[model samples]
Target: MKTQKAIYQSSLPSNTRNKLVLRRTRKRFNPKIFINRTIETTAIVSLLFTGFTGAGAMGCWGMEIAMSSRNWQHQKNICLGMMLVSFSGFLGSALIGASFSIQRDKF
Candidate 1:
């Protein structure tokens, strides 16, 4: 039907996707092969890690809020742990950004 055809069309790969490409390493698992690219990858991974950790922290915070009604110390501890993890992830991301900033500069 028309709706099915529309869905199929929408599912097709985007033709206007980002044209920029990440530089590849000369050798697999070899950071020296592409020092700049290695830093780029590290920064990207750090960002992803921070995002996941932040999400976890948010969930823990929600749980803590729910348990606040019951005055449960366990939930507070769990939330604290998650917040630490999130903070660590954010710190890691910041470190990676500071270390690899030169990689993002134009030649």
Candidate 2:
């Protein structure tokens, strides 16, 4: 009973505990610094490419929705098709984003 009480007392509030863990963990595993400018530039370019492509996909989806909403008969089919396309874009964006993260060693 006394040992259990001690353990309970040692446990911190959830927020403070999480912050402490994060701070300590970050300090332990610091990221590597790239020596070449082109490495950084390439990472930035990759990020931009992925971001813009994903955004463009979403924009096209938006246009489809807007165009489709005008009619009742075609709207349902168009919206369903757009929704499927958006879901695919979401998955593709996730994969592309992961590739960028892998290259940057951010994940």
Candidate 3:
């Protein structure tokens, strides 16, 4: 029995052991929230757009303007927030667009 436990313990790498410990510790102390796949995908797409726009804005307008006019620590954060907003907009538009694009057959 001792040997079985020893073998099991030895099989886990230190990083895996650390991660398991961290998970257990977090479960005891925190309320775990998981984002659904659709939400995650939407966030990613939004962020991508936000980043693209923000970077384009920065290049066109200059970082100094972003820093002086905005309180965001970096242009990146501003970009991220814009991304989230765009994502939300896109998610709504996609749902509507999808509904419109669907074809129904009438007998």
What's the lDDT for all of these models?
Answer: 0.56, 0.52, 0.54
Clashes of 1: 0
Scored against the true structure, residue 95 in model 2 reaches a CA lDDT of 65
In terms of TM-score, the best-performing candidate is 1
Candidate 3 C-alpha lDDT tens digits along 1-107: 11211222436787676343312222332322232345456656766786687675566356556556454345546665676689676777567445534532222
Q: 21 in model 1: Cα distance from truth in Å?
A: 33
Query: How big is the positional error of residue 80 in model 3, measured in Å on the Cα after superposition?
Result: 0.9
Best by lDDT: 1
Off by over 4 Å in 3: 1-48, 54-74, 103-107
Q: List the residue pairs that clash in candidate 2.
A: none
lDDT of 2 at 57: 54
Regions of candidate 1 where Cα sits further than 4 Å from its true position: 1-33, 69-107
Error of 2 at 99 (Å): 1.1
* lDDT of candidate 1 over 39-75, digit per residue (tens): 5576566566656655765666676677664444455
Q: Show model 2 residue runs off by greater than 4 Å.
A: 1-73
Candidate 1: Cα lDDT at 40: 57
Return the TM-score for candidate 1, rounded to 2 decimals: 0.40
lDDT of 2 by residue, 13-82 (tens): 7666544232212223334433333345554655555565556556656766767643443444554565
